[model samples]
Target chain A: MKLVCSKANLLNGVQIVSKAVPSKTTMSILECILVDTTNGEIKLTANDMELGIETTIEGQIVEKGIIALDAKIFLEIVRKLPDSDITIETDASFKTVITCEKAKFTIIGKSGEDFSYLPAVERDDSIVISQFTLKELVRQTIFSISDNDNNKLMTGELFDINGDEFKIVSLDGHRISIRKIQMKNSYAPKKVVVPGKTLNEVSKILPGDADSDVTISFTEKHIVFEFDKTVVVSRLIEGEYFKIDQMLSSDYETKVKVNKKEFLSCIDRATLLVKEGDKKPIIVNITDNGMELKINSALGSMNEEIDIQKQGKDLMIGFNPKFLIDALRVIDDEEVDLYMVNPKAPCFIKNVEESYIYLILPVNFTTVA
Target chain B: MKLVCSKANLLNGVQIVSKAVPSKTTMSILECILVDTTNGEIKLTANDMELGIETTIEGQIVEKGIIALDAKIFLEIVRKLPDSDITIETDASFKTVITCEKAKFTIIGKSGEDFSYLPAVERDDSIVISQFTLKELVRQTIFSISDNDNNKLMTGELFDINGDEFKIVSLDGHRISIRKIQMKNSYAPKKVVVPGKTLNEVSKILPGDADSDVTISFTEKHIVFEFDKTVVVSRLIEGEYFKIDQMLSSDYETKVKVNKKEFLSCIDRATLLVKEGDKKPIIVNITDNGMELKINSALGSMNEEIDIQKQGKDLMIGFNPKFLIDALRVIDDEEVDLYMVNPKAPCFIKNVEESYIYLILPVNFTTVA
Candidate 1:
């Protein structure tokens, strides 16, 4: 295989596919990216069994052939080469040579047949959404996904689509985050649980501007997102997702509106006093005058009072400060409304717009005053 | 103790002393910073047995007393507080209370008497030097200090002072870096080995562009640095430093002068082709035409030719690209000269002014054709 392409174009293309390549895998061929040169273009494909990424770039194809080269090494070499036309060629023995300016790289390549075949999306049902909106939705809910293996279903974000509106929910028992976005185009209703790791890669590769639309397709086993000349396919978790909506409280006896930035900063300061090994819970006391947050641990104890628009009697609750900070950081609102039915019940956090809601279960602090 | 000080001033003072506080120490008092409020100044001191740092700041001292509080917690609280007057007080039971605006913190404090006593420096043996020059000298030589525990003597920089000239040398067997600076004032000749950790703390805490001079004093067991309102004392590492001058070769058969920026950039690019676990070494071959750098690893191989002003016979040398880049970065001169005697011998790198010199040993290549 022989082809000539711009250094920047080649670097971007290889970077997108290399993200799906596992750094250390049992199968040696899985670390290589399959490069195909045909019909005036070069296609790069990489997969880690569960997820796969493929990207294509315009290039001058002198010969049509395929070779598999180390994804990370190839990407790094292409990225460092000075901006110029890079010439890539593969010999009959599958030794790939990349040359640009005064720099040349010779990588031992495996046969393309050695690489596992990536599955293609066969579902006719596809949804088109703005790249920026989809990226934002993923970022908002992905952080709450469980990192533990005990609850396999909680390790992925649940996506529920209805008409033009799409909602993503993520929870880890202690805290839950839900985000909603309005899609420009409508499609058949579908539900799938995308792994948090896959969504993370998508957010990084997806462009910011809405200049292009992301086409999403899903089957029973896998879901795929195609955009910006790249495709990301991820396997769906095979288990029944928890009913996150049911965990949210329906009624609240006390409510308060607080500035998001001020609240976030206060919680961050309070977390400094929370011990790591022990339960790092911060007490939130809502009174008629204002709201006070306090944390006590071996390190020290801190108390901060923030002015708030409170409605109802005074109440106090204890929860993890990190959870509240994470939820507040992802919310796209200037002010957030916090609701609590009682001191022992779960607290609901939502922006004034009421588009997204976050529920955090309070820690039992009955022994502590 | 009771005092009120500006948030910015308190934060800066706490951060400087916290650098000396041990993170995980067997002695609990070593992790705390002793705070003393008297008259109109607040003093903060922290020590890790070997090194100690103390600083005083002007504040409104209402009551004169002393207390010791956890260094990490105090710094975090001060950093998060808004820019305002912070009020700190100690109760009869030795509990420290800190209040800033609407934020309050209560930390368990030990008696100031429990803190380690910092040694006093004799002012008669102190010499003053420009902060900028000292900082530059430390930056150039510190990277070469040995990190291995087996060689205790090589784990520090040898500071040799004669009259108004001061030279610092550091080496870890494979590489050596030396920096020399001329001070405005003359002082008695002194030789001391200052631990790398101490120099690192001094570099981080010392303010740049401050016209105030830094006083340096050394004794048989300790070295002390005093500036403005801060003083740092560190224990000396006793042993004979390596004879760095003898390591310099008398004659070099080949030499090359290249732009510092261009050379550094080329070395950085070559490093990308090096793998982590494998013996990833880049070989530099100097010919009458130009210089070619090549590296081959499990991932791939890269070869790049850069134009340079060269003389004498052609020579090839293999060295770690990362070490080459690090040494080149310290040279302040626009152009750097590379001196080599043979492919297997160490290479000498120095600037045109010859104020600093770096020697990097060549790596043995397994596949040299």
Candidate 2:
């Protein structure tokens, strides 16, 4: 097998697929990237049993064959090579030789037949959406996915589609984040739970240009993402996601409208009183004047105030600062409306259009000297 | 005590002195930064026995008093405060109040009397040099200082002051690095060993302006650096440094002049053949045509060739790639001359001016298939 590719394209292709190559595994073959030209295309594929990635680079394939090279070593070699055409040739014994300009590298390769390829998923039910919308949806809601393993379903996010409106929801018991967007075309309704890890990897590889689009196709057990000449197949989590509809109610007795940037900065400053790993909650008091945030930890006590427009009763509540900060940071609105029932109830940050909603449960407030 | 200071100035002063505050210490006072205003200046001081730093910030002192606050908390609070005037006041009971704009923080403080202050150093013998020169000298040679504690003397760099010529030498048994610069004013001949840790901190705090000057004073046991309203006192290493003058010889059987950037990048690329913590040596073969570099490791083998102007007989030598990279990265020259004797002898990279010299020991090379 022989192929010649530009250094930039080859590096980008390897980096996109190398993310799925397991660093340490009982099966060493999972550490290699298969370079296959049997289909007349220079395709690089890597799979770690759960998540798999395949990317095709712009190259000239002189011979139609296949070989597998160590992903890490290949990545390093390509990274350091000069910005020119790199020629890779493999002999019958799987001795791979790579040359670029005046530099040459020789390494042992494995038979392509021994490599694991991505499981094929039927593409008839693909849901097309702009890459920018998909990236924003994942970024806005993926953070609320639970990181613990006690609840298997909580580690993945629920993607529910109804006609042209697609909604993504992620919850970790303490908070629930939802982002809803409209697709250009209507499609069949479907629901699937995707692991947070896969969404994170897809988000990184997906371009943020609004003009480009990504087609997402899924089956009962596998989901496929096709974007920018690359395909990602991920094993879907098998279970029913938590029903958060009852917990996501927008009923409230107190409402306030505040500037997003000012409110975010106030909470951020209050967080400085607590150290890492500390779960100290920040207390918020809403009145006719403004919104006041306070926090007391072993290190110190902080108080911050910001002007807000209030439309209901005055109230005080306590919440984990990080939960609010996470939601506020991804919000693009200049002013956000916060709805709360009482001190012990959940607070919702949402708009009238229901484009994005973040609900956070309050912790018990205890004033300290 | 009460003082008003700009948020920027206070943050900078705290950050500069907080480097001396011990993160983990049995004495709690060592974790605090002493704010002293008795001398009509807002000075922040932190001492960890081995090193001490004190810097004065531009602030209006309303009252004269002293107090010590937790360094970590103080630094974080100042960092998040708005860019405006910040007023800090301490009561008799050591209750500190910090306020800026609409943000306020209250924290507990300890008595300033309990804080450890910097040890007194004689200021009679002093050496003045441009901050840029000192910074450059340290950056060029500090990489060769031994990190192992087994050899205490090797962990420090020797500062040999002879009239106007100031030479700094660092060696880690495998290689030696020497950087010499001429000072604007001649000083009394003196020799001392400064711990690498102290020099690293000093280098970070020192500005890189060629116009600014730093006054360095040393006694039998202590070294004091005063610059830009800041004073850093460190305990000098008590021992004799390694004798590397004999190894820094100019005699050679083969000489080659190559582009510093090209040679550095080639060695850097060859480094990709070995993983981190692997002591792989790159073999260099020089002849009338050019220079050839080769490396073989468990992963693969790489070969690179570069054009060069040779002046002596052909030679093949092997040396640690990192040692060569360190020197080549710091040298500011278009072309660097390399002197080699044989495969087992040391290789010298120096110029006729003798302003800088780097001597690297050769490693045994075995031909690999």
Candidate 3:
């Protein structure tokens, strides 16, 4: 294969596909990216069995052929090359020669036939969605997904699609986050669990300011997303996701509104006293004067009281400070409301005027003095 | 101890002394900072058996006493507290109470008597030098210090003071870096070795914009540096330092002057082909046309030729790219001259007009094919 392309264009294309290449794989071919030169474009494809990425860029093609080269080495070379046109050609023995300015690289290429082909999705089964909405949805719910490999089902975000609105839910049993985004139009209703790793990769590659739409499709075991010049496919986890809606509490006796930034900083300071091996529980006590946050551990004890605009009955609850901090950071409002049902029951945190809700299970701190 | 001080002042004082506190020490008192409130000032001190640091800050002293608290916890609390007056007091049972606005912390403290006393340096034997000059001397040669504990002399920078000029040299067998700074006043000549770790801590606490002078004293087994509000003492490393000047060649048959940034970037790009387990050697071949750099490993191979204004015989030398990069980065010049005695000998690298010199030994390579 022979082609000539701009350094910037080639670097961007290589970066998108390099993310899908496995760093350490048992199969040697999985570490290589398949490069094909055709009519007026060059296509790059990389996959690691579980995830696959393909991207195409405009280039001048001198010949039509295909070769597989080491993904990381190729990307680094292209990124460092001077800003000029890069020429690549494959010899009869499949040894690829890349030239840019005075630099020349001779990389041994493998047979492209050994690379696993990415499965194609039917055009009729795809659904159209704005890139902005999809990006926001993934950012809001992806962080709450479980990272444990043993619980495979909980490691992915659950997407429930119905009519013109969709709900995304993620939970690790201790904490759960749910967000709903309104879609442009109604389509065939469906439900699928997308792995957190795949969604994270898609978010990074998506363009920020482009108004163009994205197409998404899913089968029984796989899901595919296609943008302007890139396609990403990931395997779905096969199991039932937790019933997050049932775990959310329905009623609360006290509701307090506090500034998000102030509340977040307070919780962060309180966590400093929570030892790593000990149960990192921060006790939140609300009284007529204000709210007091305290953390007691073998290391030391820390407490802070912030003035609040409330006169509710005195109540104290304990929770993992890290969970509360994480949930509070995701809320995009100046003021957030904390809904409490009882001292030991789960508490709901959300924006004062929005439908978004985050539930965190309280920790049992009776054993600690 | 009872005192009230500005949050910013307390934070700065804690940060400087905290660097001397050992994270893991056999004696628990070594992990705490001794706070003594007397004569309208609070003194903070920390030591790790080999190095000691003490700083004093002005405060409103309500009571004169002494206590030792965990350095890490105290620093964290000071960093997060609001920008206001912070009140600190020690109870009769040695529990330190720190209050800032509405926040409170009850940290467990130990008796100040348990802390080790810092050594005192005689004022008449000290040499005065600008803080800026000392900071510059440390940065230029510290990177060449050996990290191996077995070679105690090579793990520290040799400081040679004579009259009004100060010279610092460091070597790690393969490479050597030397820097010299001229002082204004004359003092007794002295020679001592300062551990790299102590210099690193001193660098962190030095103010970037301070123009004040620092007093430095060297004894038989210890070195002391005193500034406006802080004093640092470090134990000296013993043993004779190797004569690194003999390693540099006097005559060069071939030389080339090139842009420092351009050469650094080219070497960085060439090193990408080096694999982890491989020898990781990059070859530099200089000819009339230019200099060609190449690296061949199990991962891949890369070659780049940079144009230079030279007409010399072709020469090929291999060296670890990281060592060359580190040497090149420390030279404070736009263009650097490289002198080579032969293909296998150590090469001398220096600025065209500066007195600083860097020597890098070449790696032996077996040519294949």
Q: A225 in model 2: Cα distance from truth in Å?
A: 1.5
Quantify all predictions' global Cα lDDT against the true fold.
Answer: 0.86, 0.92, 0.84
Q: Candidate 2, DockQ to 2 decimals?
A: 0.81
Please list all clashing residue pairs in model 1, or write none if there are none: none
lDDT of 2 at A241: 83
Quote the positional error of residue A127 for candidate 3 in Å. Answer: 3.8
List runs of model 1 lying over 4 Å from the truth: A238-250, A367-369, B210-212, B277-281
lDDT (10s digit) by residue, model 3, range A190-254: 78899898888888887844487888888888889999899998898888877766677657877
Between candidates 1 and 2, the one scoring higher on DockQ is 2
The CAPRI quality class of candidate 2 comes to: high
What is the Cα-based lDDT of residue B77 in candidate 1?
85
> Could you give candidate 1's per-residue lDDT for residues B190-244 as a string of tens digits?
8889999999999999895547678888778899998879999999999888787
lDDT of candidate 1 at residue B183, scale 0 to 100:
80
Model 1: which docking level applies? Answer: medium
TM-scores (chain A) of the candidates: 0.96, 0.98, 0.95
Q: What TM-score does candidate 1 get on C-alpha atoms? A: 0.94
Looking at model 2 chain B, which ten-residue stretch has the lowest summed lDDT? B240-249
- Chain A accuracy of model 1 expressed as TM-score: 0.96
